[model samples]
Target: MVYKMSVYYRATMCITLMLLLLNLCEKGYGVNLRDMQVPCEEVYMVKEGETLNSISEKCGDPFIIEENPHINDPDDVFPGLIIKITPFRLYSYKF
Candidate 1:
């Protein structure tokens, strides 16, 4: 019947829209949206022979020491420590 066809068409249109959105997001938009949400921070693993300052410099966040108060001692940082930096969204990273 016409009603059944219309329902099918609507369902198909909705599915197509959802697929397009998902594809766009997966390609790039998803990360941008993810960065907006709370508790999103980069987890950096300390490498051997690397200091906090050096790591922070590599990360491009100069004031990382002040930002991460969780680090009890700057000098005490060692390999395998996961330093959590504040949420950062690069211009290129955003959609």
Candidate 2:
């Protein structure tokens, strides 16, 4: 009876530990995993002499205008505007 109780206690503790680990694994960097399902985004900082036109041209995609809604005006972008950039991705997977 004592051996059976010990085995049962160990099993319960192991299951609890596994569940705790799984819960911790779900939260990553405070970013919602669902938001990233729409697009794979990159962070880019505005630099001197860099305009929205220039950045889009460099990226070879005018879609930056659509992706970056914070930029009210492409021409009106100023230095230090943190814009969201989506690069062409070959594949994506969940962590």
What stretches of model 2 exceed 4 Å from their correct place?
1-41, 89-95
Tens-digit lDDT string for candidate 2 (17-83): 9888777657543444445442334787888899877877665556888987877877887788898
lDDT of each residue in 1-95, candidate 1, tens digit only: 99999999999999999999888877886465555543334777788999987876666667768877888899998888887766554443645
The C-alpha local distance difference test score for the whole of candidate 1 amounts to 0.75
lDDT of 1 at 11: 100
lDDT (CA) for every model shown? 0.75, 0.72
The model with the greatest lDDT is: 1
Query: What's the lDDT for residue 35 in model 2?
Result: 50
Angstrom error of the Cα, residue 68, model 2: value is 1.3
Per-residue error at 45 for model 2, in Å?
A: 0.6
